[model samples]
Target: MGSLVVFSPLFFFVLAIQMSSLMVSLSQEGFCSAPPILNAADSTAQPLYWKVTNPTLSPSHLQDLPGFTRSVYKRDHALITPESHVFSPLPDWTNTLGAFLITPAMGSHFVMYLAKMQENSKSGLPLRDVERFVFVLHGTVFLTDVSGVTHSLNVDSFAYIPPNSTHHIKCDASSTLVVFERRYSYLESHYTDLIIGSTDKQPLLETPGEVFELRKLLPTSLPYDFNIHIMDFKPGEFLNVKEVHYNQHGLLLLEGQGIYRLGDSWYPVQAGDSIWMAPFVPQWYAALGTSRSRYLLYKDVNRNPL
Candidate 1:
């Protein structure tokens, strides 16, 4: 097994529109329901039952949260599954917190999450995995890698880990971080031995590089033909034409905004968002706003056939 860590900001944009009458229409038919309570024990505590707990913090921006006089309490992002696991979706602008399990899938198996870290808690559990990537969303942390190397990562700082590499984290005296994890597949059991100077061992390309223009670069074939790449699109730029290829791909927007075309329909996309497209799904996208949009794009080209 092997791992690669490319630390960068994330971006995805999705427009969530709720019509005023939609709430009444749903209640009439009982379409919406309340979520259940969750109880979890810390690494070393008797199993305890817990319900959604709201914090007493106040909204930072008055203009952003109108009508609400104070910050409201919200429940935990995810519900506990019957199997005793936590699976939650990434949080959005309204709530700067959430987490979910990324394991139990064929392509990637492991738990991954995104949320605002607690300022008072400086320690967290470290796990053994093929690889890991942690990006700082806000605040700083003391990151220790497998080799006992330590580094300070503040907002916008990123880190990558190789397969089987052991690493731990220590948040700054008081800081918050958004963590992302990627695990290897033990089922496939086929990977080129980690080799240096080999064509397949090349590192992934990142945005704002000195040698290449990001938005203009397109992989001729899918699975990237190599490692994953993060690209950026300046306002007004776009991948206007449909791109059809054999590789499966995941695109997560890190910044800016745009409309993505997927089979006769156009979907709006922006930062803190993601989309999964396979070979059969022909898709393309274009930037839609004034801000430069960046995104994390990952594709595994040399995996065994399903």
Candidate 2:
């Protein structure tokens, strides 16, 4: 990992209150347990795992982690899952680095992360130019956006933040959160305001047989940087129900098990697994087991190619 030497000189303003208490907490590793360790070295290893194994070699800045691979990324079977990092919630902040998962994408450059923080900890990330889309998969977290309004984000809690907005996050209990962030690309027509919501509060759009149901997390009325969706697929159902997409997708399977079609290959996927597909690549999905398959998905839309 040649890129480990360049850390952002300017870190966000966050003071991890319990330095001693924090180090001790890692031992408990409750629902927020660290990534599983691979006893052997992997050929597909990326810089992230290297840094995880060797923190002394870490660079101070945030950049493209490009961990895993450019194609399908299965968390459990990854040749290398970047070692999780403990840093500030915000990339610029150098404190309380939370253990993070980093993955690569095509159109937009995003090192996505799935973070778990202990209860009573405050994420010392100040809103800067970072555009972040956060989803709470487990537990609860309090999110304060640029408007100075704080919302309690629990399981299925989702929020979107535009660039240059000031926000803060503090947790009274242990929580697991996933963050998808990339530089904001501005276009007058695609303008959108901040969005804060939870799928629990939204109606599930479904068909008569309940074959497919979708929870639209981001507003599609006006296009913005990207769109997030939580889709539930009945067992044995396929996502290609006829419509395909011109938009690229970065997806994470939140629940259930299934076979996913990517380009020309089909791979078995389960909860905690992820996939990144390019625009126009042939793709579809089929749920497995006895229950409905659900996933929190992301897509880039509403902007023209530069």
Candidate 3:
């Protein structure tokens, strides 16, 4: 008993270390927990959309400005739809003109948004429903949602609206926001036309968290596992340990910093980083700074094709 007691703490310490490493490994391997069933502990399992914080400029928030510098992936661009294009076809970030990274288009699903904005414009030109997101390296803008949620956005600020949700904006300020064009499955079309003037109450759906510009890291047409999600990890927050049966992960780092371990390589990633890993890549990481490490995380919840 004496020998056992002395070794017990060490055993637990080793176990804890192993457990943390294993947790990250599993996440990297695309081993994510299944979405809970209806009525279970987390029955809803709906996507939680985070609202953009800090609309007004405060002295304390001044230092948060990311350098005007930007990064772009140097890869061939692929056209996904009528409005969206994929690839790192833009100029390098080191250029004085700044970088231009295009996101997959927001296709015709949300045409009402563009139409409303056009109606308000002097030319009254109709806009397409497709939405696209782009990261802004500098400046600010005035943003107003359909419900009159008015606010001033600054550099690095993010804006997100639910599919079919109406919003209007004016970038006549010093703020530059990366616009992420998100095109949802449009599972329901009833709300598509409820733009700037709808008497009906907003029918809410699971919305993705709000952050700077972002687009679907994975192709929409690709019949991936039915249940996939993307989220930003705040410093130190991690996905708990769980077993996963699926493989194939698509990850993109949007902002901040972190080192992601995929397979044998520890890829140090920051804004504009992306990785496509095969099944069982044994992934995980820790945030490298006080700001949250934001990324577009995609995993096949079901179905595995070689």
Q: Identify the leading candidate in terms of TM-score.
A: 2
Error of 2 at 71 (Å): 9.7
Top lDDT model: 2
Q: What TM-score do all the candidates reach, one by one? A: 0.51, 0.65, 0.36
For model 1, how does the per-residue alpha-carbon lDDT over 1-306 read when each residue is reduced to its tens digit?
679876432222232112213432443443333122112233114211110011111222223335533111112111121122222423322213354423224233334444444443343433554454565545667767656878777654556554566566665354433344445544343332221121123334544423223431223333223343556667667674467766655554555556665554445544544455545456766775555566655454544657
- 96: Cα error in model 1, Å: 12
Model 2: residues with Cα > 4 Å off, grouped in runs: 1-108, 124-128, 206-210, 241-245
Relative to the unseen true structure, what is the C-alpha lDDT of residue 271 in candidate 1, on a scale of 0 to 100?
50
Candidate 2 RMSD computed on C-alpha atoms after optimal superposition onto the true structure: 15.0
Instruction: Give residue 172's error in model 2 in angstroms.
Output: 2.1
Q: What is the clash count for each candidate, in the order shown?
A: 16, 14, 25
Question: On a 0 to 1 TM-score scale, where does candidate 1 land against the true structure?
Answer: 0.51
lDDT (C-alpha) at residue 204 in model 1: 48
- Expressed as tens digits, the lDDT of each residue in 1-306 for candidate 3 is 355435454465345455545544553453433122123233224222111121111223224343312222222211111111122311321111211233223111111111011112211111244333322334545557667877654444444444445565555433323333334433332222211211112232333443222233323333322222345567665544322333544444544555554443344444444454444445665555445666544443323344
| Regions of model 1 farther than 4 Å from truth | 1-98, 101-112, 120-129, 173-180, 185-212, 215-228, 304-306
What's the C-alpha lDDT at position 258 in model 2? Answer: 67
